[model samples]
Target: MHPTIPGFTYRRVPVADDVTLNVAVGGSGSPVMLLHGFPQTHLMWRHVAVELAARHTVICPDLRGYGASDKPAEDAEADGLTYAKRTMAADAVALARALGHDRFALAGHDRGALVAIRAALDHPEVITHLASLDVLPTLDTWDVMHGTGAAVGFHLYLMAQPPGLPERMIGASADAFFGHFLDIWTRDPQAIPADIRAAYLAASRASVPSVVADYRASAGIDVVHDQADRDAGNRLRMPVTVLQQDWGTALGFDAAERWRAWAPDLRHTTVSCGHFMAEEAPEDVVKAVLDLLTR
Candidate 1:
């Protein structure tokens, strides 16, 4: 129920046996799927989707364990991991196919950006274009966060811990923990409306375990998947656009250079806004996605 994206309808799409994604779909044209990140749901795309809807069919979904989507508990015995980005990326591909979109432009922010990268790599034939906002590749990100840099991404370390403790600590005060990012990530607190912020907090609180599992997989199993891809020299062949803050300078790497390694056909630049770039600076996001489509 994103009031801003008028006429959009919500549906529960079954992407897997145990996973059903809550999706908001509208518009009618070349399709474009937008995915949200941590602490927020598909609602983050309200503004951008509305504008895109004028020329492209816009689909926004609460990625499996976020928003109003089904929250499946972690089953440790399911091989080494359950919430890997590969699993989440599968959901994105299935969701689009289920909606009759065999090929579409794809864009995502934060956690969703990671999923989009995985999707573009895994299902490039279906995802014609790719856009990632405010993130580095998961492998590069982990490399940067080791040692003293770990303090900057304390949440990454915390969630990477074995399931029980991180879940308990976060669940104890989910609102405070999730809300802390909402306050700090945005240069302007007014960028996200009060109601939207409340919705994000509520969703995070309700999906604590699923969300934590998502992070846990990133810390453990996700690295293995990324390494295998890098070792095999599997790079993203599709045209890609990445809009992000220049955190690389702080982390001692050329952000664009790192991205160029994976995205061979790439457009990488730093946007002026904060982590919630899509919402904090919707026009910039829309323009970037449009540029990706145009390319």
Candidate 2:
């Protein structure tokens, strides 16, 4: 059927070379692109898109290898055209451009949040405003958490395993494997309905290898990009808003301060939700995005 959000139409649009993305577009006004995270689809923005669509054109897209998007086999040295953050960011940029938006406001959840950050850094001319949900920068995430705190992010390590292992293991019980994160990462289980959860599991299961490849690239090539940005002193010049759980207190960091190092005009807040803030707290997520756009 459809996602939890009511009265929205789904369409698949070709974005980059050899790739097309499943995107949900509705409402009418200034464009706002919403990118979903790991193990989820554009459906994650169901609630938030419905509300934002009332006043703005909401474009939600499933990133490559995640939902309905084309999942190319992993090629480690694909000449900068793999599922890494840079390529994924290009896909988003192409998607927006194909949708006739030279510039747009962008908000992303979890893994998508990392892509959004890279988009802002790499394609500053096209992204006007930026918002990240429930994730820190790649370098910050890897650097800040250690010991037991790092253990909580076991998926990162698990997905980083050599080819065929993670995919084969996760594929054995795909639903349970993907569902475990959905069940534990969110404070509100009711946020994602039964049918929607089933859809997520199905999509995630079919794309296990690609999913692992995406994460694997992050630990390797993605970090290279992040480090380059750090070395170049590149920072997000646009107005940036971040809504996340208070991982800083648990991991010994001042989250806002760390983000400020990357985003000079940043507004960071810790919400009362778990990792899936967009699905769990859609209204707040929408409000945060709209506020950033307005400011």
Candidate 3:
């Protein structure tokens, strides 16, 4: 068993479709759910979870295709299970309800952020506050990366390729594939310990198809949902905070300005840390969430 925080204990609970999720529970007041990003697990939030558990009921879970959860194969030809963010978002909502939190604060990183946004939009009654780290909504992300921005996000396009291709290519050198992001995305490499890095690579290697399917869903079905929301004039109604890298200069679009369109009560800022802000700059992330919740 992992060492428990002063107020939190680890728990494993089943969610939608008989999929059991490994979760860490801590703190007391209002419930707060944390969803981790790609190449990482709930363990990524060890530091932040404990800190938040001091004041709130912190609930951290390994997202659907990531650590310890079921990884159903994708049938990209049809709108398969992996193609829908709604399925993943439903898992989160069910997980929260299983934990007795009808409504709670929610935060997610990278791929997990996509799920968090869907949860807030589809089940606003269940998400009291929302925070997304290092990602824009699906359609806006695709819209911004037209020319040079697309080059920087080559994986986004590469992963969108036909099923067997991306899975085989990425699976061939999983360590290098996952490690490349870990090295380039983080301003501080030492934030993730060597053992943890190895574990991430191993888990990623074992789940190549699932990982590829996740990105593929972004390009296909997820974009459809995002566009539908745009056409419907939908926006997040709850308080929202977004922390991202300074992709403005690099990607040629102002991140804050773009997010303001979707979240009117948004507190968007670009941090100096790399994509793994929660692990690399835990204090800043914690402070940002606290400030947003209080606001």
Candidate 4:
């Protein structure tokens, strides 16, 4: 059987036309929606979800095109819109509404953070609190990424290429491609047990194209939408918190300052953890989320 949070009830909730998300809901109280990142599924939130569920009804869902969620076929002409964060953000909002929530706290890691950012910007009325773990806004990300420093993100550029090549390349060695991030992005290897690691690889292997489409959107249409928001001075109108590895100096940008421009009431913290903070340093993540909820 696939790994799942022990006490959560699972459901396939329709979020869009011909698309439904695989969701795990547990606990009761104020609702909080959690979105999982790439190379992982909603199970990534198993630890955090359980902890948060003690006081809040936690909703964890595999974002569209990832994990067990629906992956709609994308026509070439769609121009990455099918997997754009805006599209995924809408799916998150829809999922929350279907789950009997009109507005809720939102938190995401990596790719999911991008979707959370877009959701906050587009549906401010629906997101009451926001937390982004280890990522910048799409526009800020592309802006700060440059030169040899950008080499760390080789996968980003790879998936950004026009459809076929990326799909074929990643599909050819799906395990290695996805496993590389899983292996290197964590400091506490024990945080993800053998079964969990296998589950992640298996899920990623099966969704190579959809996963690439998700990343490709970040490099293309996501940037455009973020740029449009920036041009209009649109920012997240909610209590926002961000957690990240202290790599801003190496990347030649002030992480907190960058986030401050977008999130006026932002609480940005630099942690000594790897990219998968939610799994590796779940207590820290939980504390941050709990604090944000109070704000």
Best by lDDT: 4
Candidate 2 residues lying further than 4 Å off, grouped into runs, are: 2-4, 79-81
Local distance difference test scores for all models: 0.87, 0.87, 0.84, 0.92
Clashes of each: 0, 0, 1, 0
- Model 4: how far residue 69 lies from native, Å: 0.7
Top-TM-score structure, candidate number = 4
Residue 205 displacement in candidate 3 (angstroms): 1.3
User: Model 2, residue 205: what's the lDDT?
Assistant: 89
- For model 1, what is the error of residue 128's alpha carbon versus the real structure, in angstroms, after optimal superposition? 0.7
Please say which candidate is ahead in TM-score: 3 or 4: 4
Q: Which ten residues in a row have the lowest lDDT in candidate 2?
A: 1-10
The worst-scoring run of ten residues by lDDT in candidate 3 lies at: 1-10
Candidate 1 is scored at a TM of 0.97
> Tens-digit lDDT track for model 1 on 128-186?
99999988889999876666656778899899888799999999999999999999888
